[model samples]
Target: MTLTDVLDDWPLWGISKQPISANQISILEGGLTNRCYQLSLESGEYIIRISAANTAELGIDRNVEKTIHQLVSSLNFTSAIRYCDDENRYLIRDYIEGEVLSDNVEDMSHNTLSYMVEQLKALHQVPVEIDLPVVNISEKAEAYWQMLATQQPNNEILKMKPLMQVAMSEPPAGDFCLCHLDPVLANWLYTAEGLQLLDWEYAGLAHPLWDLAALFQGIKHSFQQLEKKSKKNSHSEIEQNLENKILTLYGVSDLVAWRRACMQMEYLSSLWYQAQAKKDSY
Candidate 1:
């Protein structure tokens, strides 16, 4: 539950038989649902992630995550999970030394782009051998809204309520697959083991397009932020070409539905951030 607790209980973590000093642990940037620490053990380095409280209330199912993660790990699409807690309190994985795909996402070589898309394609095809839960877009949005409502939401948050409703009104994508649901650029890494998606809390059975929508939107956001910082005009055409290539490569012909899913993904992302901001207890 706390850094002190983790350090004090090191032997129980399935890391090493030997004890480790406090100086061996250092904080690392983490995702929305957990606090991360990199432990430099004598054998090697590892990442110990302490999950946030009330994960179930935030639409995260640790059991489902574990099952799906094991499947992905087998395919070499994610970091090797060295030790997973029985109570879902913490996870220890080998520390991956590599770069995220965020900066080069907008201008990756053609072969690199294809390889990335191929990885995503392969993930979507993973068999639903285990009984995994399907994602409920509407319910998830409402759950986030309820949490946010208690926080004295501001004007921006208030306005998102309606926009979220609008996004929810659209029909769901026709197909389902084992989707990562959060394939944003930062989650992707090019480690020696190869490309891997680090975060697994949001993974579940969802539309194939949900991952795509998240991916493209992530690229657009990264480029826009960079453009603003550099004081350059935003290049909408680059975004268009990227989308076109993905559409053609992934065989997604329904532009209307794809665009709709992208919009809904944006609103859903906004709601999750506001809700998490108010409730995150690390």
Candidate 2:
């Protein structure tokens, strides 16, 4: 269906208007859960994102997303929501013109990791009350394991059960902040000024270190090349550099607490991927 047809029934516009004519470019083809389109317009491009595979069935709350977007926008950490159809879960956003950090971080020179950490720090600094319903780490893991039980008998879920146990046993020992729970490379755009975050579907109130750990896990393999290309730096040294940058930017004085948070996030990563895999199959 055309964008106009899909959004034709939206009540927010009240009066129906013709959809803006633009060349529709499909930028993200690999995302399993959402159908995202980049609409190139005469004035500027815009993004049109729609949930896939019945996100509502998988615990996605469009109303909660709307609230989170407003909260995050107030702090300037994410793009402002231009228009939303809460019932249909269609979103229109002003497209950001910048390179995705995946491409920009290829070489990783001159404190690029540090810059990202600082950017994340600025995002976490935004304090706001999150009334949104967010899936906790244990719930996320349980969903994955449940899917595994129904799909294939994979021992990986059994192996991860204990890890999840350890992670959820200890509650967050530090202050909670507004966190961008998902840190995919596509979610970040690097501009001349700084990094801009996109995609608020997974945002909520959580420990700040969650985002940091998620980013590290996502980019671990990709950043290896950056580590090799760096002058006089070992892989461990590069990893440490990234960690220090995150700590410094977030002003984290409790290293032990932060480390525990990162560990928890790593296990959550396993569950997230597992969940995505199940969603793709069925």
Candidate 3:
């Protein structure tokens, strides 16, 4: 709904105690699967994320997002959610103020990477009670493949689909913990208190390396995106030595295995983009 549409309903939507005359809201850009609006009122700043059409088909479980957000908030990793719609159409949360990390994605410093590794280590230690679904490359690739069954998938993507099965069958380096599968740079915010990761839509149980791998791949993707924006013809791959340092900081022993895990994440990321593109076409 447009801001005007939302304002027409006013307090009827239960946004705040203030009436429509007192309410102030503006759209926040960079939403991939939902529409986000920054709402300022007499109370405080909040973010209201309006769900997109057919979001469920993207394999996002709003219930899991609520559970993970609750835990992460207690750990001070993100702002607390103020409200979540009963039918999963929307959610309201504290609009955190900080430097959105996407602005620095292409030239992220070593210190930032180190800090992120430390936080990820703490996150991996969080206990998981429920049987959360695994967001492994094999499972997600297949699911996304089925979602795009009618559409013509890219030739490269078709070839990469079978490779995920091998990674899925291999024994993981460690047990599963809560993994944030989508650490895309846009969801990151560097705050004075600490690093704040927003958007827990893809949180699930998975190998710890999955998050690390996803981070590595996500960073590289940001660089590519920057190059594309400038219409550049060539771009170098993210330095393997830097990836090595990230693994070393994370205490990864099996370099070969980690590379394989990174490949799995790379494939899954592509499939996810393809699926989202297909969804948007509708």
Give the root-mean-square deviation of each candidate in angstroms: 2.3, 4.0, 3.2
RMSD of model 3 against the true structure:
3.2
Off by over 4 Å in 1: 103-107, 153-163, 166-173
Q: Compared with the true structure, what per-residue lDDT tens digits does model 3 show for residues 192-212?
A: 887998999888887888889
The lDDT values for all models are 0.79, 0.66, 0.76
The residue-by-residue lDDT of candidate 2 on 1-282, one tens digit each, is: 345654554445422244544344555565657887876644456677876654644556677667887777666666767677646557777777788776755566546666777777777787565464544667655655666565657655576676667566563577677778877676778776577877777777777778887777666645676667775345666665666666676677887777787777876666556666656532
Compared with the true structure, the alpha-carbon lDDT of candidate 2 equals 0.66
List, residue by residue over 1-282, the lDDT tens digit for candidate 1: 887776777777676777778889898864656889999987789998888886767777888888888888878887678887678888888888888888576566666667777888999988888888778788778878877877755536676676667658654558889998888888888878667788888898888888888888887787788778878866666777888887888889888789878877887898788787767555
> What is candidate 3's local distance difference test score?
0.76
What does candidate 2 score on TM? Answer: 0.80
TM-score leaderboard ranking: 1, 3, 2
Instruction: Give the candidate number with the greatest lDDT.
Output: 1
Per-candidate TM equals: 0.90, 0.80, 0.86
TM-score of predicted model 3?
0.86
Question: What ranges in model 2 sit over 4 Å off?
Answer: 1-27, 30-32, 54-58, 133-135, 153-156, 159-163, 224-237
Clashes of each: 0, 0, 0
